[model samples]
Target: MDSGIEIKVMNPRRGDNLVHPVGVGHATSASSAPLSSTSSPLPDERGLRQQQQQEQGLRQGQQRQGLIDFKPLKKWVPWIVPGFVLANIVVFVITMFINDCPKNSVSCVAGFLGRFSFQPLKENPLLGPSSSTLETMGALEVSKVVHRHQAWRLISCIWLHAGVFHILANMLSLVFIGIGLEQEFGFVRIGLVYLIAGFGGSLMSSLFIQTGISVGASGALFGLLGSMLSELITNWTIYANKLAALLTLILIIVINLAMGILPHVDNFAHIGGFLSGFLLGFVFLIRPQFGYVSEKHVPPGYIAASRKPKHKPYQYVLWVISLILLIVGYTVGLVLLLRGVNLNDHCSWCHYMSCIPTSLWSCKSQQAYCESIQYGNQLNLTCISNGKSNIYTLSGERPSQAQQLCSNLCG
Candidate 1:
């Protein structure tokens, strides 16, 4: 059921006809009973041999009917996903600690939380850290990544969450989707997919959305969904309710992607992570072909009539193609990003992918430009957008200080 399929087999015994939930390797027949000691002149070897052949034939038939779960059961405990959840929580706490909104701002939302109080709700509807705090903690900023050579932001941004609500939604999704995947595939594969997909998401977001800072694990979570879809397709023969499963997964993906159209959602990261994870899925989550017997599953002294290939020809073909596409896509995306290529300029309509403007809200990107002058331990910031100015007492200017104050002034 966790695999989104249930396999039922008809019991073949003559007397009591009953249908039962018999998965792969559990098929039974009346003739499968052990031979009596005095009954047969034939050697015990002959009986085992015949039994092996019958079982093999039955399994092969089951394979043709798609009644087998050829892939092995869960060999890994679910720990990596939980670890990811913990890591995100810890990082969010650190971000809030550094934000120190009560000290930094005139007032704070949820001020009762004291040092853990959130930035004003208008500034961050997600109830999270200040944009400057996020930027200092390695949020995704195109200017820093391209000009300052802070490529590490691509990976680090995924661990940073904007607010309590932002982390809450992402962590819940990670727990619901990630734990099951880790249990089925183990940590290494799932972990790589998570991290790489997140980087891919950041890379994509950096290329287009250069105006504001971005942070969240939405991309990584989307990558998990993409992988799930590809895993189902590549291992299509091993599953039941194939059409139903495919439709359900597709519907879920569509709905989630559609949600990205909302403002402030960062759909670019979601799309990028999904594409990356979809290709990576073909490379990492492939399964042995149906009817391909594992040597460990074979009975002793029974030789396989023919050794089937581990994967079907199409699987190998898909694997190669997906790998090539992934490499090429990453290389081109990185090169374009490092070169300061704004994908928005090249594709005017593409911005709609991230946000669609409606009568209720505008999708226009807000650019906060400011002039800053420091004198006698106080920095004065003037927002060019509205000619609004603010002065803050500071010993030294930090990189994101002017930008954060300007964002406030402009707002």
Candidate 2:
């Protein structure tokens, strides 16, 4: 579902440029006598010196304001996005190797790849590993994380991809959105946004989607998109053509979120990541107000009559509100999750947000029941729903494992 698009950044113009003192020409013209009158007397040395000083201050203020308006902070070398890409690729390769689909099942797609072959299409249409393989590899499973104290899955799940298409879409979006933000804001801030937003996404997914394992970087990608929108708004005065940029970003976000409505797509993660990143944007992406002067720009022996505030009042309000919301949301979510509270029980209509049932396909969770009987060296599974039977070598597989296989067959 991921597609790349370029964002247009307009040139910044100083909105408050008129407030600065007028230039020397204006001052001289005002001081001169009218054309019909006799010529005015020459100004004194002290008066001339004062006028020159005033002009210098005016020029300095204009220069500093121009820098504030037009110049961006030092650009950061874009290694973080590339590094994340490499890390995700490495993890996917390792996952494929460990999956060894050929060894696990009687048949596998693309079997010529040996251990790297994908699970049967019926099992994993994403062209990746089986559910058992992903589960063992630290997919985000609510029961395991809550009952077994395997909390690391929250972080680990972000690096895991469900299949080839999943990783490709996510990584491409990451590169497109992430690199620019990193270059403008530096890696530390951008990295924090990615990780924290991902965690937030996982937390929400765990609460609502309790039946299956969830994996992918879609949440984090949405977080970056969320940050972009908030950054545009909070730093509203600095950018040119603000309305157009805002609308373009909104369109992109809306399209992406709409895709989440498809069956099997996790929209909770998208919403959670977006909300967290939006708040974080207000806290982290704030910019100085127009016409603000930095101390470094002040000339020796010159004191400004008055100074502009560094940030607008609205920015401060947003920062405080967002910070508080982030903290409370995380705390309340963690407490509820640990307590094993089922969110669906409280909100009857919430499930529809993740998926809407349609005539072409059903959104109900498939829970296939099957009876398994094991002989000395073989196992037989009979699906209760359709009375279909399949046999496989016992091969040390557990009861739960047999059930999963039967579920796939029934599906």
Error of 1 at 78 (Å): 0.9
Deviation (Å) of 108 in candidate 1? 1.1
Tens-place lDDT per residue, model 1, 1-411, is: 133222332323457543332234443443443323343223544665688799999887656434222445657898889999999999999999999886677558999999999887767878988988898899999999899999899999999998888899999999999988888899999999999899888999988898778999999999999999999989987888999999999999999999999987899999999998998899898888767766766556555545788788899999999999989999999999999999989998999998999998888777778888988868888888889888887644455545556777788
Candidate with best lDDT: 1
Model 2, runs deviating above 4 Å:
1-70, 297-306, 394-404
lDDT score, candidate 1 = 0.83
Question: What RMSD, rounded to one decimal, does every model reach?
Answer: 13.6, 14.7
lDDT value for model 2: 0.82
Clashing pairs in 2: none
lDDT of 1 at 410: 82
- TM-scores for the candidates: 0.78, 0.81
TM-score of 2: 0.81
All candidates' lDDT scores? 0.83, 0.82
25-134 per-residue lDDT for model 2 (tens digits) = 22222223222223232344346568779999989887765654445567889998899999999999999998887667767899999999998788789999888878
Candidate 1 ranges beyond 4 A from true positions: 1-72, 304-306, 369-406
